[model samples]
Target chain A: MRKKANPFFYLFLVVFVFFVMFPFLWMLLSSIKPLSELFGDKAFTPFSSHPTFQSYVSVFVDYPFMRYLWNSAVVSTITTVYTVIVASFAAYAIARLQFKGKTFILGIVLSVSMFPQIATISPIYIFLKNIGLTNSYLGLIIPYTTFALPLSIWLLVTFYRKIPGDLEEAAKMDGATLMQTYWKVIMPLAVPGMFTTAILVFIAAWNEFLFALTINTDTNYKTVPVGIAMFQGQFTIPWGEISAATVVVTVPLVIMVLIFQRRIVSGLTSGSVKE
Target chain B: MKNSGMEGQAGVELNKQDARLPVKKAPKRERQKKESRAALYLVAPAMILIFIVAVWPVLQSFYYSLFDLRLSDPKKSEVHLKYSVDLGRYLDNYPFLISSIDSEIKKGNDAAELQDIKEKLQSLDEKLQKDPKVKSQYNAVNDKLMNFKQPSEDIRFADVEKSTAEEFSKTTESVSSQLNKAAKKTEFTQEKKLLGLASGMKDSIIKPTFIGLKHYKEDLTEPRMWRALGNTLTFTVISVAAELVLGLAIALLINKAFFGRGLIRASILIPWAIPTAVSAMMWSFLYDGQNGIVAKLFESVGIVDKMSNLLTTSTGAMFSVIFTDVWKTTPYMSLLLLAGLQTIPSSLYEAASIDGAGKWKQFTNVTLPLLKSSILVALLFRTLDAFRVFDLIYVLTGGGPANSTETISILAYKVMFSQTNFGEGSALSVIVFLCVAVISMLFIKFLGRDLLNDGNGAGR
Candidate 1:
């Protein structure tokens, strides 16, 4: 298409791509290898050799990896659903509602979202534990809802703000109560924003390792990250086992991203809300 | 285009074109209190959970830091049986020996039948009481006996010497016997274990409690803790700085439309999107000194003449852990910065070019200042994350080779889960929160406002 290209530029790009993908590719490749081969004579190219399905089998057979996946799925789905429902109204208030301390409330929620998980996990763990929610689905669900609400509220607020007030005023004049108007009116229109918020909440909940790991000790209640971290710890960390499990686990997330490619807004994901 | 679209939907003023939208329609001020009450009620579930898990934890940890609490015992603050078998003790022992045995009355060397061999092995170990050579090798033998199998033939595992190796032979024999007994016992319990696993876990683990700040004070005052803290900060600062710069560069470079751009974008995200725990595990293996990829790279590049284990030495271990962390998180840093880059209006660039601004000047005067929010967000998130870093270090190095990579988070974990030192762990948790707050406040002072403001402009 052009004059001779800069070989160095192409080379740099190739190297960069390779560097970025090498670990994940290695992960996928290594997952199929037997433990012996994974830990074989340590060569960078150990991945290129004969691979096996032993690790995958072992992860399924030896551990409750499937339970972990189910836990993650259930938690993420509930969190996402609840988050959208809760946050849409909350954000609408912040964005369009006239109320005292609106800015303060919005700021508070935003600050909550920014609050480090580590800073909050200890106290949360104790409180949840006291309620017999520790190591329970209810415990995990409640926390997930709490942590996700802020971001959901923030993003949905932006989306709600973008919707013309006339749309809501018409419904309000129709004598729809606020809840009905929010559910039947603002919601039907904010599908795109809702989807964006849902995906983000799901991702956050799915990948959350800190609170999940600390609070839940039982494998059945544990989410994927904790499941995997603890799952194969008994054995010498089999890259094959971890890799295969990771693939099984991450494939769903990857598929989700791919299917919802439209939602993949690299900027804070959909840039659906301002802080 | 507008007329064509409006023609079908038009009965109700399709010509109305105001972008001003009411996010909410509040009633008169007289009814405001009623709405506020309703609003609080609606948000109660989420707020209550937040208070319980997030807010309560911070406060409880602070409160617990004030008094001694223990999990291993309801009376835990009492320092009885607090010490546990740990890496240091394990290393210092070089091998654990149960006891010494008198070497007498052994049949011919048929490697001893698995049962008799274990008995003989157990006795031989017991007789090593005063013998340094036998005792030193005792622990290693005992481990193999307990494990009942050979360590994998990874480059990561070095060969025990022949002299030490022989001791292992006897240990293996003992393990075979133990395995038989375990198999027999499990055969009966198989059905029960399958169903009772949940109950078992619940029974075994005691509930966690709030312990006071004794441990945090100890960590602060202790030289070892301070040294570890210093190392962690140094590692976090250097690696995070490198990652921020590198991520920005990479994101900017890849942001442009190019051949295979989609593929490259996904590729870059692959490393980031993979769980950090998985990456840490992979890198730890790669950092294996012998036959390791990292070692090979270093050797060939002449950085070091010999195959040096990055995990075995203090400085090397620190460097290895930090390098691995940077490699894994740089993509995330880049992605955040990239989002920031996209938010910047392209008109500014056009205007700059019209003003005769050079590329470097445009980047410095226009691009950088504009990207400030994104940079601040990226820096704040990454720095806070690095301080609490545990999964990576736990999987990669286990805060190893003399605890060089140990951060407050890891210490909190060990104190709570491992030692069952709830008081100490709670104290440490409060400290960790303080550390995070201080760092975050500093970030806010420096660039936090821009990042917060950027959030508004971020969501389109």
Candidate 2:
């Protein structure tokens, strides 16, 4: 049924995989090494003679990493939930209903996605400061939702278009109103699409650094990326602790990617590629 | 007889239904109107949120760029349309300075000159209190200071006429200089303290710093801004071109139905899944001067002359950043192109092969042409992203080794937060926004014409 693969194909695959995974492997190896070997000449050794979890222990004890993790989780969760709900409603209206100025609205959404965050950060910081929302979770959540809405809406619109229109017509024939049909009939069928968008938005919010760095500067409100960036030591740079923290923050994201690779790929490529 | 009766009844019913068609059209029109209204309701929340967070802030940044706003200077921290005076600062030093002068006059060292200076100071105080608004604010601030309570910002400053402000500043400056001269000539103990208070009073006069378009003109002529822009363009072009070639190769490799393709795809996402800041930090470690493995490898392999040369030298730092970016983002590029590759039917390849085309010929004739739109779209996204790079370079070299690697966004951030020059920073931000708009327009006009039409159809 299929031709046998060539030796060069496997060789190329191994090389590609090695190139992509080298950093992660190195990161993992470096995280497990003790400080003495990490900074000493033995650092070039492929494996440490005495690998330990001291860096991981120090990361949790020496810094307020647990708080950073909690903050990132809270902000990212709220942003993902808020963005998906609002974007879903807007996407449905554009996909399933005929409305005036639909093209104009889509244009606005598209342009907003391409807007550079640096340009809008100053006013956002000032506004949040005025309202006493800076250094709070709500400040980050609001901007994250605003930035994530465009992509989520675009992805959901593509998904919503794939569902047959006859289903809604059938619901209408059964005496269901427009709102009821949207709530009970269409939403259940669109759950997978919403889930895919949720994953993409969550990763985006988790990875957002600029707003989190500028807006929430208080130690109590720092997220993972900002917290890691601000790590320091008296004389030497704390490479082991930083590597441990990076490993801690990145493992969950890697697992998520592994589990939902297909969904994420489809969500990313939905608008760009033709079906 | 039954057939004829049924036919006659059916004909009568059809005629009645046809007569009611015009009447039914009214409700259909009303339903269409209601649906449009419902669409507005559904879209209102997202639109309002975006306007609040994104659109309104850009307008506010534009407005702020029109004035001189520096957080370091107390007087210029806030925008002032009219001349005003900080009564708290004025009252704090005014009473002490007057007493010091009076004490000097009592000592009778330069009694005649001191008397003349006292009379001038009295007239300046009277000139200031002549305004009813200033008098009330002055009294309130003085009372609060005496009671050891701090005055609020709103009541601390009071607006004054331009002429009155000019006279007050002039008298204080001259009197301070005279006092300094007197302190030098006479060994008066309180004269030093007196001069200190007098100099502090000079800053109480708050002049409006609303120089319109000054920051924009300065930034436009500034060599640093131009260099930063140039650096951003160089990074965007070189890194994107590298990613395109490598990503196309990876896409072609994975498009074949091979064993463990899923595992390869998943592993490829690891680089992309890591945050840019974290990756930048990782590369910084790998490129460390003494103990870095990658740096040593490069030196031994003859890519660089020394291990430390990777991040310490300007060209090497730029190369290091671009290399890290290509490593981090090639997976994303590959994925996008792979999506495009998957869309190409197998029959096309089969037809080409049947026509006696080789692998390279097939790729040139079929894959390149079909993948053009995807490549363009991917380049547009990656170019814009690379132009606005902040987290990577910010954490890596900090735009340093003499700021040779600074991009526009990094420069804007430094100007805004590190230096606390919001007005100039805002001007830079507006320029960045304009560049982004121009880039988007160029992409759409030249390369994305069909893509835009396709996007509109998909949106509809």
Candidate 3:
């Protein structure tokens, strides 16, 4: 550790933390204020004189927010689960086995990560409509899983490589088949890495707006992001309910980040940095 | 102790000994083949999914771009390879029109000219029925129409010869004009319905909408496309550059040994963890003209002339979005850079200090050179991400203030979905894809070579 911190460093930290935390703080505070207080001079006040949970009630009662939350949960959960399973198999293959076109496969994964989603939206929409999959959970899950595979595979490959080859050799010597060795031995060791990938994948699927907006336009299947985006009222903007919904959606994610901060950071930078 | 050089020679000798073992080579090769087969099986599911969802759709979009497909226009809704007729529509009008003309002729109004028009229409209908395929479909559609039931799609459209389609269109047009002239001279009750049915018959002759590459030509030359591309580039360059600087500063700050470092790190990630749409909404609220706190802060700090001006003006809206982006993404950038920073050995800084180097010199000499790859990787990711921005601009300003903030993706979406011009929108989408491809190629060629090579090596 350094001997002594400078005053300027402390000042920078204070300013940086404030800049980062202000929006979240504002969102939470604004969600609790009454509609009357939110519109006029009282909006500037950091603390509302009389806080109310009316907006929270309105989010669930007046609007179909419960359905949106359920829709988002289902889509994100399935996307995360499906992406992790498929990506783990591919990642294990690339990491443990010598194969032709491994580099080409990795290149494909990298390119898919950078693909623009708008370019593919129309055809996908047409396809979903033709197959009657639009306005269904599978519609969002399919695309979300496809988009999440690249990063999940990349992260898992790094994790799989860290496991010793000797263990697999030992398992093989014990008369275990290749699939048995993978399922019984390697997968157990990859749980931490999968957890990290799951967090990232779930967050991504939860936050995906474009595909959700286009693919599932039915109100019954609108996810949280789409629901909040398309939120409206007869005459007003419904900022209060929107803010309440945002807080509801974001708090769980913030908690997840806090709990898995180290894993998340390591998973994100695994392939990018070399020592 | 044994010499290290001798250990290397012994290792090579052991490999040679292994090679001499009997029947070792064949089984080893077989095992290797089996492993390769297993690897293929493992990777096939993921590759197939990606192909179906991502690759296939892009190719389909390219194909759709070759035609003029508009949802609002009934005839142009799908790809038409050749001239065809909506038989249901034709039967709906053709029989009614023929009967109306017959009644007019019986009324003794220009009998000779009306007789010529009626015979022409009969010959055109006969010519259309000469093709067996059209004849069958016409009968099927005519039956359905007579029963007052809607004709199914398979039986409703029939392919016709180009000559037949042209004659059908011409006869209906001429007959409708002649009826119009007769209606002016004589009192006729069915004249208005007859003219409408005649014109409707003309529309039943569907033309081929496949204008190959025409949309591409128009969009590539259009000023609106150029402006959207310009806006995209401007947003990408400015926001990425700002994030690089601010992220570097934050990365350096958080990398130091300090109190509450973990807490600070987690707190900063809050912005990134929030969904982009939600964040856009949050910023819009903050930038609201009437009651927004950030807008007021900007005005009081002299960043804007007024609180409302921040989101209402072109320059101010651009500045506001860029500022919000830098706020949201800088933490992610810093996190990546910090990973790179942690890999640098502390001994290098110590050696620099021993050589009488100051902080600035150490950053320039030791840190920047080693951190080049990380910086490039971060920039490549951020640049592409910023270029393809949609939800943020879509939700915040909605590409408004006279579309000064419309990016290529937003414009493509509007063209495709809002206006239902799928062909033109598809052309725009292909353009966006081309731009992304070019950007990726440029980055890979100039800066990301080592990063990609490292990716390949990492798997090995």
Candidate 4:
């Protein structure tokens, strides 16, 4: 038997939800509104009198928006793939194998992951310069994989440890080699964990600003975040185009994150929460 | 029987390592050793990658902080061991300048002044001839200049002593300044050319720039660095505290069974899920003085007297950034706390209620104590993150309206990239790392003791 809530409770919920949703809603509405109406001192309503797709169209026509999207996509995809592969191997060894210094290695990974990116920039920049990797996709991919590995390993290790030991024992009893059991049984069970790690890694690489800003100087190689920030006009900032670009870059990520909301939440909280 | 069997097993295990009569146990041990080797192989790629990517760079950053590396100055672009002369640059300008000076003196216009300049040039050239290596390189470079060939970098550069470099630079400066004054009065054909060439020679002297810890000393004394750090600390402390309170409330609110809980949870996560850069840009518009609805709303609420004041004033910009950060991250904070909340049994709440504990009493006695570890973990992560903040504050205020909002990370970036001062930038980066390490140590040493102690006590 559910009891009726107080009126103030409903009011609080309504206000809280509205406050949470306002920025996104504002971004959407502002993206569609004509430039003239977007800045006017009108009541804060959801719609404008003259709505247009002019800003969205201009983002493509007047800028290298598509190129930035491609660069971001390629970088993020490669980063996710590399991070997942490297993290899985290390995580599997950590979770199951009776190896010496396993605890020490995990501790190192955790501490390094906490290191501020600023500390690593100058050396990485110089190192990449020495190796001729600067302004290249491989440049961004390597560091992204390096930084993402610790978290990916941590999350995957948590999941891998939760698997039943009997399952692996059964695989061994059925004439399976150690590699064969890992490939067939463990891989299948760990797929969801890998998927979650991949999504988070992709999102992280996609949104990364500092390295992307520093590593790629050529506009041809710049990622979305840097590209959008560098968008310029002769005398004025074209706010409409910027807002449209933000919407373009952000909406797909928002949709994807919402779609995979449960997996993301679980992946994020699993390591930190000590059950 | 059990004790005897265990002792027998232990005796066999102890003797197994003696390798005398334990052939049957050897295969299992061999397999275990092979597995350990395999694990090492499995972990090698990641370890090497991490070293190259993460560990190596930090070490490299520390190395770079010792030098005075500035990309804008060609001489300081790379580390130098000895004071070197760009024989190529010297040859390119020296011969032409001498010929021009000779021609102007021959023209009999400003003869005395031109002769003085020529004598200064000759003395420096004679100084150059004193060193055997410099003389040989100078001759070879002079030959190249005669041939109108681009001097090869290897053959065209030679090291000079500190005194020679200083004397040569001083002479070049006086000669150029004198020529500059003479060129105004003389209508000689090559007087202007002589002045330009002399000044170019001054730039070719590369100094040994291995200034160990000078940048660190300079930055430590610089007030701008301290101000940026203070701003970062202020933002971290205030924003994190706000997020904690709001996150705890939201966690409590959502922890209870309610209608539309899933929708509320999903909607709240949308803020956290958006890319920080995009959200920062979005907030930039909302904080825009001219047309931002959020700014207008703030004005209406009397938070500020003017709509434009939010991002344009020092206090308002800091407040706006912190508010935006709280808006974006409270959901994440709540989610972490909710995970902690889930672990608390409802029986504890029921028992508290039976003990005449009201809601606030239950919250203090039950929720707060149980949530300590979770709160600590959340605070640790958020504090480190908030401390290293760059993109949001970067995009929003741009550390601006007078750089009042610039954090240490943004300051490092501006110094390193925008100004191309890599040495000082690296020092700032090391400082940030030190600060982060200290914060992590504090959390682990103090709060982590309780978190770990409770686990051990409970497990036993």
Best prediction by lDDT: 3
| Residue pairs clashing, model 2 | none
**Candidate 4 local Cα displacement, residue A93, angstroms:** 1.6
Model 4 regions more than 4 Å off: A1-11, A126-135, A170-177, A231-235, B1-29, B94-149, B152-156, B159-200, B447-460
Q: What lDDT tens digits, residue by residue, belong to model 2 across residues B352-381?
A: 999999999999999999988888888888
Clash-forming residue pairs, model 4: none
Interface RMSD of 3: 3.7
lDDT of each: 0.63, 0.85, 0.86, 0.83
Docking class of 3: medium
How do the candidates rank by TM-score, highest first? 3, 2, 4, 1
lDDT of 1 by residue, A43-93 (tens): 456555666788888888988888888888888888888778867666766
Clashes within 3 Å, all models in order? 32, 0, 0, 0
Name the better of 3 and 4 by TM-score: 3
Per-residue lDDT for B229-315 in model 1, tens only? Answer: 787698779889999889989877755545665565555555565567756766765666753566667668876566565677777
Q: Model 2, retained fraction of real contacts?
A: 0.56
RMSD of 1: 17.5
Q: Tens digit of lDDT per residue, candidate 3, span A86-190?
A: 999999998788789987888888888888999898888877877999999998987786579887888888788777565676576466888999999999998
Leading candidate by TM-score: 3
- Where model 2 places Cα greater than 4 Å from the true spot, the runs are A1-4, B1-26, B99-111, B181-189, B352-358, B447-460
TM-score of 4: 0.87
